[model samples]
Target: MYIEPSYIFLVVPAILLTMYAQSKVNTTFNKYLRVASISGYTGAEAARAILHSAGIYDVQVEMIPGQLTDHYDPRSKTLRLSSTVYNSHSIAAIGVAAHEVGHAIQHNKGYMFLTIRNTIVPVVNIGSQMAMPLIVLGLIFSSFLVNLGILLFSGIVLFQLITLPVEFNASRRAISILENEGFLAANEIGPAKKVLSAAALTYVASAAVAIANLLHLITVFGGRRDD
Candidate 1:
């Protein structure tokens, strides 16, 4: 019963949620990407302005390649923005840039959740990389290894759960900063909110996927303990 087909059944909900989240994010971003902010600032300028306004000077903003591939590297204290976001003056671009900067700001502020998430990065990385192999080998060889693999994989689930708040808070901070600083007009905030909200749902969907995977392991492997 602990086969790929069984696992598929278990993860179907998460897979569906992930698909919906992706579609929503794409639709929202495309809809808002055409609308320019009244301030006429590019995404890089908006990110720089937000960082300066927050009294955060250490985090450097750099243009990175690819679409919607923006992220903040806390270890390097750098904010990497995709070309579309770094150069475009679209409201969606600014909103996304601002959201990434919010992560830099979080780093500066020593946000507790962010701190915890960063602390576990190494473990999660290793776990994600090794979990499948270890789990398969355990299934073929020893029950102990199966439990070990399952335990390691749970780190990924925990990481995803912690990430939900980190992402949501960053988006919230981004909009608040944009609105309060007059970077986004009153009417402009709606589209920005929609984009951020859609993006946040992706994180939720990711967590769901992780949880589903974890549950499938427990359902399948947990039975091995009795045998």
Candidate 2:
């Protein structure tokens, strides 16, 4: 029931690191958006071309209202882009659109990691929301509950681990597609890669922080139960 100073100290650095990583990603993405122009096609047009070239006719590219909210929905078979990406002619926009299309390509080609990530999506979603509460409750109540919390929290961590590959692979696919399909010039490649790489790091930071916090939690609570 008592808060551990050690755990607090450990989490403080993780919180700061994650925030800094997120800020860098946003700053880099915006910087590239301003400097690197998309040669001709808009992000939506480029995404469609990429999808059509891959013989993916069923996927739809639609504009949504937001900043950097682009994503591919496997369930709906839709590639959703924020207004900036959907309308802008910028390297960052194309890069992000291509990244989402990369997910569609993965789905079509049956990428193993992507498939596994999709399969665990619902379980991870529910587990993430419930894990901390269950762990705290278990700490206050019973050893059995605490162990159950550990198992559940472990699932969340596993999901974060699985997500790393899925995200990295998508960025790799985006870069490859941009190069092969002539969406970006040689100079544009640098900025595009930087944007995608920055975005990917945010995921890495999230996973790292999650695992660290979970370990801190277990170290404190589990040690208390032993005594």
Candidate 3:
């Protein structure tokens, strides 16, 4: 297989940014994880309180194992918090909990971006799985396959792009809820913001990587149609 120099040029920087984003989130989370919030609300309590404040009593808050694995399941209407965030009263924990709750709030409010993201998730999953194999086979066989594969892979890139505003909005909502609800002290809010901001960087890096990969594919295989 011939490697394109453009692949390295286009993709390597995004990969490096991804590595940096992961490191930053981990480091920032850990740093804030040790700083207990003055509110003294465990992550679970903080999440529940915020949900109740928003009149979202139907959503269940539950604990799950792992670090940085917290998420909101809109279908189940459940917010699953990781062990790190579920039990800890640290500023990082509360911020993360609030962020996941923000997603629940979005679901409740019918946020347009979140709705679009959820609707396309199934299509994106199929596209992501089939894209690479189609692209590779196209290289060996038909131009039609190449074009089809690129189209499928383009969905993945589109999904990533759509995800950015969703994540950013959640983080912003988390900050606002945390401040308004007094989940964190005036001094502690800054540290919580740092944690959420670091996490948001990871999402930005992911979108960058997806865009870079899409560009690489277009540059390398886009013109392979049979003449």
Candidate 4:
């Protein structure tokens, strides 16, 4: 039950940033959600238009129930829009929808970072799920397990690091598409960009938290070994 100073110095700030990021995204999205786009295209229509414009006709746009649960399924070539986004003609909806289409475009073109991120997804998944448990058990049992767990946890950090560019690229693409494609008016573009930017902050925050946790683990456990 030994507490590491690094936990307070590293993990706490990361956690706070994550909370702020989450709150910012929600507030920004909701604020723009009420402002309907001048183009009158729903989120699903915007996604489809962006895909088609990218010459990616194979990706299907589907509506799913949830708030901010939108995602692109690269394997199935499907872009799923959340309930809040699917039928909404708001600037926030179009920006979020276009962002998902950016992923589709990345998939279609085999964007290098996205490809690399997808490639190790299975391993990262397993590593993330088992890392904490392994670490906890190792504290009572074996240093070897502790080391192995830290190695596994490192994959999570790596994944998040790779994800930074992917998410930022998508947001940039979203903003460009919204502006160039006339999805949002000149004045509305700023708001749309704000929505996407806020969403991107969440990814940054997540990466920070992952790195902090990894550092906390290494520092705490490494100190234990030295003793």
lDDT of 2: 0.86
* Model 3 steric clash total: 0
TM-score of each: 0.95, 0.93, 0.97, 0.96
What TM-score does candidate 2 get on C-alpha atoms? Answer: 0.93
Candidate 3 lDDT for residue 158: 91
Tell me which of candidates 1 and 2 scores higher on TM-score: 1
Question: Tens digit of lDDT per residue, candidate 2, span 94-159?
Answer: 999999999999999999998998998888888888877887787777776777777778788888
Alpha-carbon runs more than 4 Å astray in model 2: 1-5, 36-38, 223-227
Prediction RMSDs, each to the true structure? 1.8, 2.1, 1.1, 1.7
Local distance difference test, per candidate? 0.92, 0.86, 0.94, 0.91
Top model number, lDDT = 3
Which is the better candidate, 2 or 3, if ranked by lDDT?
Answer: 3
Best by TM-score: 3
lDDT of 1 by residue, 16-120 (tens): 999999999999998888988998989999999999999998888999998889999999999999998999999999999999998998999999899999999
Report the Cα lDDT for residue 216, model 3. 93
lDDT of 3 by residue, 73-143 (tens): 99999999999999998999999999999999999999999999999999999999999999899888898
Residue 119 in candidate 4, Cα distance off native in Å = 0.6
10 residues in a row with least lDDT, candidate 1: 218-227
